[model samples]
Target: MDTVMKERDLAGKQREAESINFADLSPTSGFFFTSPFRSLSTEGCLTNVSEPAVDGDVINGKFQQAMQAAFSDARAAGIKHPVLCGAIPFDKRQPSALFVPKKTHWIERSAVMAAVQAQESELPAVLSKTELPEQQQFMQMVTDAVKAMNDGKLEKAVLSRLLEIKTRGAVERPALLNRIIDQNPNGYHFHVPLEQGALIGASPELLLRKNGNQFYSNPLAGSARRESCPQQDAEVSRVLLDSGKDLYEHQIVTEGMRQVLADRSRHLHIPATPELLSTPTLWHLSTPIDGDVLDPQENALSLACLLHPTPALCGSPTRIARDLIEQLEPFDRGLFGGIVGWCDDRGNGEWVVTIRCGTVNGDHVRLFAGAGIVPDSSPESEWRETGVKLNTMLRAFGLN
Candidate 1:
């Protein structure tokens, strides 16, 4: 028994060594996981007085300041091109996780490495059983969302459901978050630590970023999570792109983004069409709208702030979808569906739409997933869609 325990310990150490080596070797490294989500609210450039109005200029101003700070620091460090991405709140909603404990730097490294090591760990060993709704309940939710759309109640809305998970011991969850970081090297991976809250699975869709005179906004909409079979996955992607339901959802976001950029930008180019993007789990139809800004006044952070609760993440005809979301959804989305990213003075940064995410409220964690509802969308299918989205985060936790 001791030999087995020692062997496991040795393996954990080896994983730790590998993770630290990767971090040391990589030219680009910054904070990752939900912890950064909460920390930024209090400690980083995102910390600033918020505007009273939902759509106010205060956030914009603060965001600009944040860009300035990052840029100034980067210039000093001789880092020519620095990319920052993480979540920032739309409404100044502070994290629910009250006080996060400070870990020594080595412990922090361990936390990240431990998450990677646990990727292959058995979930049944860690997760407690929570009764998933019978298939009928999931179907009913779908039916209702679809009926609402038919009745003209929903132009588009992101309806999310919950899956309760129980864990043994102290609920060592961050270890799972780190493995997610291990798998994903393309974008910023963040986890916002909450006091008595949950975690999130976020791959941001909103990129209000700039390089020199080039400015771009990549708006993501319409998604179908990937499956095991490549052929089936390709079919799903094809269907999602061609589906009137999915296209309708994607178009609303594209149009809204174009309008925003046109009104603010100097020279705008509308791609004659929408393109598709793939993440580890799902396929997304993304539209990248670029324009030249003669003024060059808009900062990525503020622009992203204005675009928050977008139709892609929230819903369309903004106000109506928001109203319906509040009225029907059982839970307040908090930061789960909020934007989290960073920016520097050069207008260079990436901000992902907060989806497939959750927050930690102490030992208990709440995770979230949402799906866009259009006229042709089936509630059951949408529910399953969220399930696939949830896997992005759950897999991080080594749940799958």
Candidate 2:
């Protein structure tokens, strides 16, 4: 009895350990996401995307009902633990790409990084480069928006431009992911599947995060390009912290979020001042917000939908700013400035603001970046800010 029972017990334990072995994944298919805490790699689909979710009240949200149903479907299919991963579009009217994967492998973020080899990855040669709005047109758009602000049209409008790069050969997703990881290790790295191309980027802004009844968000605004010299970089960081125009822009985002959380939170805390947060390419004014949920039913997706298009991404007086943005900006935003992250069946997840990201499809990639504009904002300066922001992704391709 002792020998046989012990052998069986040892074998069962080994098999359980083998089931969770880290997956060696290819970036071309499925979904992948890594935050400071953990990493998730998924394979086949357990629950594919359904029809677009209907927009409802703040708590029910644009994707909440549909997300809940998807979880139920996975549970019925005998999946003990189900987690949904994908991107939510900037506009709820557009179709989103959220699904529950059939097989999932979870690993620690540190372990994933430790597995990385230091060898340089190869990228394709550039065939051509194009900007959607061109430089002059984008500057003009900014000038007009500033003029409108002077006319009291709205408090602010965050404007974005798109840059498309064509390569002689297909850009390798694995190589690009490696580059981003090697370059920006402390970011919220994601590669979410879209209807057309995959949305891949390392965003520094935390849109929303929920664990049970507690939530956290850190929005970034008022950025300055980082200088190569340490002294200049430090000075730039100091100036960014003191710049009144930048401070006003930062407050617009923080105060707007404070109002949203005030209505939905049982308790809340927001500092009177913003702190400086740095990335590989830029330094930004960041405000971290914390609160406990008033409604236990509101999960990550629900809360994300409610707080998205925050003043940092869109503008204050959201409806009015969106109207102006629609009238001024030429292209459809698609998933830019939207939220991307994962939520398990338990409703705990992290969503990052989709900044410093690009859409990759075959041999071509489209990168998007934006700058927050207020009345005192200069057109040329704003244009330069956007270019510096694009450097975050450009460096991943070894271009910056």
Candidate 3:
């Protein structure tokens, strides 16, 4: 049996070697995954599979089964430690996962190494595909959310708006991805190709990162736009830390995460206070939570699935917030407010909240941003917060 296994592995490697055709592959046809502050980037796809989450399981048991099959195929192709990438919907159902084996090529660079790099060297000016939401409409949404909070219907709700941008021609996706990497080197930069479109972003919030039994999560909630002046920026951070309403809002997320993770964690460490984290465009109240999993079998994706759509994205009392989002928001949110990253068969992976992200399909791109609406939240201020968030991606397109 041992000899037979060795022979099979040798044959698989031979087949993989013969199948290499770097000249013909499109960037969208392959898989990619990278970690924040890491030099290594995984590329190419050895096998891929996806399925709808039709049952109680959030990760989609069917998808998990399909992943196992893909893993088997990958190993038969002489690949080990296959990695999966893609996004989960705001709704748990209809999640997608792509399994790329360890045999996938690794590139060490400030940018992803791919065929798309050869297509274009120039960046195009961004054009709006849809008008921004009218102030009255957005204000009304904020007012309604505040009313809901006052009426005890919900403690908090995250309301979002979409900004659709287009280009004269297909925006060179690889170029855009590289720009995001260059601009936000400290962020969780990702470029995941989907069946219909691709999800790209630089996320500052880490949903989950698992290494064996150890896990880490950094949830960012209350936010303030960064100021150009150093003094003003420091003042903004100070104000955010002192704001009673913002602190309450931040606590809702931190406490919620503690409750959910505590059961799975043997020794969970949650700070009594949230620290400030900054991106190029905004400053956020962030709490970093770490833990040791009670069960070693519990992997990254499973933990991410358990904590996704946190109060940071949905709101406090998740069920109520989700219902409000469906009724209040005009868009479906597809992959926005979801989680994206990759997990190996061993369950180690890094999944970041799909914030500060845009979906690209050819020349069209849709960007998304949301703000937590508490009782004291201002409609105008919430709208501006989203605008600040959108700037992170817009700047990558050369739009100020």
Q: Check candidate 2 and list the clashing pairs.
A: none
Better of 2 and 3 by lDDT: 2
The numbered model that scores best in TM-score is 2
1-400 per-residue lDDT for model 3 (tens digits): 4423542443343232223433333333455545532223445666665564333123446656676677777778777656666677777766555556444543332234343344445667666656346557878989988988887869999999888887878877777876776678667777777776788888988888787787888899899999999999999999999999899999999999988888888999999998889999999998878889988768777788788779999998999999888888877887789888777788777788988889888888888889999988989999888888999988887775
User: Alpha carbon lDDT of residue 375, candidate 1?
Assistant: 74
Model 1, C-alpha of 92: deviation from truth (Å):
6.5
Quick one: how many clashes does candidate 2 have?
Answer: 0
lDDT of 1 by residue, 1-400 (tens): 4423543453344232213322332111223432211112112222222222244224345434444555556556665534344445533334312121111011233344444554553323445534234456655655665676776756777776666665654444445444556555333455544334334454646455454455666777788778789899989888887878778888887777776666666788767667778778888887767777655666565566666767787776777777676666665666666776555445544466666566544345566677888777776687778788777767756665
* C-alpha-based local distance difference test score of model 1: 0.56
Task: Highest lDDT: give the candidate number.
Answer: 2
Give each model's whole-structure lDDT. 0.56, 0.80, 0.75
**For residues 185-297, could you state the per-residue lDDT of candidate 2 as single tens digits?**
87888888766768899999988878778788889989999999999999999999999999999999998988877888898888899898999889999887878989887
Q: Order of all candidates by TM-score, from best down to worst?
A: 2, 3, 1
Against the true structure, what is every candidate's RMSD? Answer: 9.8, 7.4, 7.8
**TM-scores for the candidates:** 0.71, 0.92, 0.86
In terms of lDDT, model 2 sits at 0.80
